[model samples]
Target: MKVKVLVAAIGVLAVMVLVGCGGGETSTTASTAASGSTETTAAETATSAQPTKASITVGVLVPQTGFAANYGPEAQQGIDMALAEMGVDSGVEVKIITADEDVLDASNTLERLKKMVETDGAQIVIGPVFGSSQQAVAPYLTQAKIPWFSFLGASKDLAGSGGTAFVWPGADQLTAGPLGDYAAKTLGYKKIATLAPDYAYGHDSITGATDTFTAAGGKVIQQQWVPLGTTDMLQYATKIDKNADALLMWLVPSDAASFVKEYRNLGVKIPLLMFLGIFDPTFQEVGDLLVGEIGLNEYNPNLDNARNTAFVQSYKAKYNAIPNQTTAFAYTVMENIIQGVQKSGGKTSVEDLRAAMNGMALDTVIGPATYSPDGIASSNRYIVKAAQAADKTYIWDPIETYENVGAPK
Candidate 1:
C-alpha cells in the first residue's frame, strides 16, 4: 500500500507542476530608485544614492520530497499564482530557488538551506516547511541575516525570537484559539484529549489549544505525544479508549490516517479534530474515516471570494482536486512578496523588501492578511467540519470564525 500510494502521489505532482507554470509569463526586471525616499544630504546623497534594481530573486525552500512534501508543491503553486496575477517586472528578474527539506535528518536539510542562499543567490527566503526543519534552519538564517518568510508549522519559538525569520499567521495562537472555542461553545465538549507528535510543532499546538480551551472552561483530560514517523498509532488509540468528548489530533497525512483507522478498529468512536495538516489530499484516501471530522484552518479555500473561488477552480481544473491550507498559505506567501515588489517599484534589497512587506496589507484569496512587526499574521481563522452532501464529495464547511491575535490594531 505504501509503495503504490507513493508512486501515485509522484504522478500527481508531475502533472500539477506543468499546469502551474503554464499560465505565468517570464517575469523579471532591473531596479530604479524612488523619486524621493532615500535620506541623505546633497553631497552625501550624491554618493549614497544607489539605484533600486528592478529584478527580484526569492528563495523558496520547502520539503518537496520528504515527510512534509504534501504541502511543498502547493506552496510553489501559490507562488506561481501570485506571480501571474501581480505581473511584477522592472528589468527586475524574479528568480525562484526550490529546495527539498529532507525530513529524514537535520544535516541534509541544513545543506539544502546553504545551497539556496549561496549557490542560488536567493536574496529572500520563503520557507523551511516543517517545525523541526524550521528550528534546524532558524539559527543559520539568523547568522546570514537572510529575510525568511515561514509558511509551515506554527512553533512559538519562531515567533519573537528576533531574527530575519518572520512567521505568517500567529502560528499556534491563530489555529488553536478558534478551534478550542468552537469545541467548547458549539460542540459542548467538556473534556478532550490531544494526540500529537512529540516535538516542537506538536507540543506547542497542544499547549496552545489546551491552554485556550481550559481558560474557556473546557477540561483537557489527557495529552499523548507520539514519535514522528511512527507507522502505527494503535497504541495511542488504545490509550484514549475512555470517556473523552473529542480527540484533538495533530499528525501529518499518513499518521492521521493511521490514527483514524486505529480508532475505528479499537471501537473508540469519539469525534476527531485536527489542525491545518489535515488539509492534504492524501486524507481522502482513508474515505469514511474523515467524514464529519472537524478541522481548523488558518486558510480555507471554500471562502466565497473572487480570488479564492478562482484559485479553487484553477487548481481543480489542473489537478482534478480541491486545495487545502498548505496550498492557500503557500500561494499567499508568494502573493504577498509580489505585492511588496510592486509597491517598492521592483526594489531588490532584503531590508527594503522586508520593510515594504511589513507596511503593506494584503487581501488574500482566503481573507484580509497583514503582518505585524513581530512577524506574525493577524487574520481570521475558521472552524470547518468535513461534510459530504448529495454531491458525493467531501468538503469543509465553516462553523465559526476567530479574529486576529498577536497583532496591534
Candidate 2:
C-alpha cells in the first residue's frame, strides 16, 4: 500500500491597466503592447515566487512472504500511522513504494531494493528486516546514495563512514549486554550454553552474551547454530548440554516457539535465557510453556511511559491488536525521518537529511531516543520475564531497565 500526498496546481491571473492623458496624443497599439509586456512580467514574477512542491518518495523493503511475513504488515501499519500524523498539509507531497524482501534469498532481496530506487524513484528507503538481507543490500544502497532506515538489529557495520545509516530502534548488543550481565552476575549462572540460528544475528547475539558472561566469570559450555527455517528442533533440543547452568538462545518467533516446545518435550532441564524474541504477542501464544523464561527488549506493550501508553492505545484502536517490537520500531523510523524532513524544510537531499537525522533526539514510545552520527540508535533496554498477568494474558514483566543503552562502537 502507498501513502501519497497530492499537490494542487497554483494559478496566477495577471491584470494590467493602461491610461492616456486627456491632452496628449494617444497610441492604442503602443499602449496595448506596453500592457502586454507588463502582464507577462507580472505572470513571470508570480510563477517564480510560488513555492516548489517537494515530492518525497519513501521505499519500504520488507518480507511480505516467507518466514518473516508477519513483520511486513506490522511495519506497514506503523509507517502509515506516522505518515497520517505528519499530514500531507505540511506542503511536502509524499509517496511510499513497497518491495518484498524475499526471506530465503539475498540476491532476490537486492534486486527488489534496486528496483525500488532505480525504477520506483524512491528518495529514502526503509527496511529489509533481517540482518542478512540488510547486509546483502547495504553496499548498493550506499552507492545509490539513498539513505536507509532499517529494522535489523544484529549488525553494527550498517552504520559509520561508508555504511547505510541504521535505524534499528534498539541495537542487538544493547539487549545482549544486559542479558549476559543478568545471567552471569545477577542470576549467578557460571556455565551457560548458547543456541541460535546460523546467521549474522545469531553470531552477533552470542558474541554480545559471551563478551559479558565471560567477563563476569561465566563459561559457555556448549554452543549450537541451527540453520534458518529448520522446523524440527527436536534433534537440536536433544543435543543441548543438560549439565550447563542455563541456556541462552534466540530465533525468529515461530522457530523459537517450536524449539521451546521440543526442548520441553525432550525434558531438557536447563533454565532458558532469551534475547529479542519470545516477548508478548509471541509470549501470549507460548506463555503457558515459557513461564520463568527471561529475555531482553527495547519496548513492551505494557511499558508505563506516557509516550508508550498513548502509542499502545492508538495502535490497538486502529489495528485491534497489541503492538509488537516490529510495529514500534517501524513507527520510530518514520517519526525520525519525518522529523528530519521537517528540519530540512522538506528537503530530501542525502546530505541534508543525514545531517538532520544525525545526533537527533526524540521522545519515542520506548522513551527518550537519540541517534549517533552513524545512525545507530540509543534507547532504554528492559530485562523481562515471561508470566501471565492478572488478566490471564501473557506479558513480559519488566524486571530491570538499562537506561540509554547505545549501539556497539
- The candidate that wins on lDDT is 2
TM-score of each: 0.81, 0.84
In the range 1-409, model 2's lDDT, one tens digit per residue, is: 1222222111111111111122221223222333244324333332344443455777777766555667767777777666565543344445666766666667777877786788768788888777778778889988887888876463677667757666566555554788898888899999999999898878877788888899999999999999876778888899999889998998888788888888888877788998774642466767888888888877788788998998899999999888988888788787787687877887876677767777777888888877777777878888998888898988888999887675755
Per-candidate count of clashing residue pairs (backbone under 3 Å): 19, 0
The sequence of per-residue lDDT tens digits that candidate 1 reaches over residues 1-409 is: 9999999988887654432222221111100111011111121322334333455567776666534556656776666655544442322335565666655455666776787678767777888776777888888887887777877545555645456666776666445766777788778899999898887778777777777778789999888898866778878889993778999888877778777888898777888878775737665666566788887877666777787898889888867878777777777776666666666677645566666777466777767777765566777777888877577766677777776753434
Error of 2 at 332 (Å): 1.0
Cα RMSD of all models vs. native, in order, equals 10.2, 18.3
**Lowest lDDT block of 10, candidate 1:** 26-35
RMSD of 1: 10.2
Checking candidate 2 for backbone clashes, the offending pairs are: none
Compared to the true structure, candidate 2 yields what TM-score? 0.84
Best by TM-score: 2
Q: What is the lDDT of candidate 2?
A: 0.73
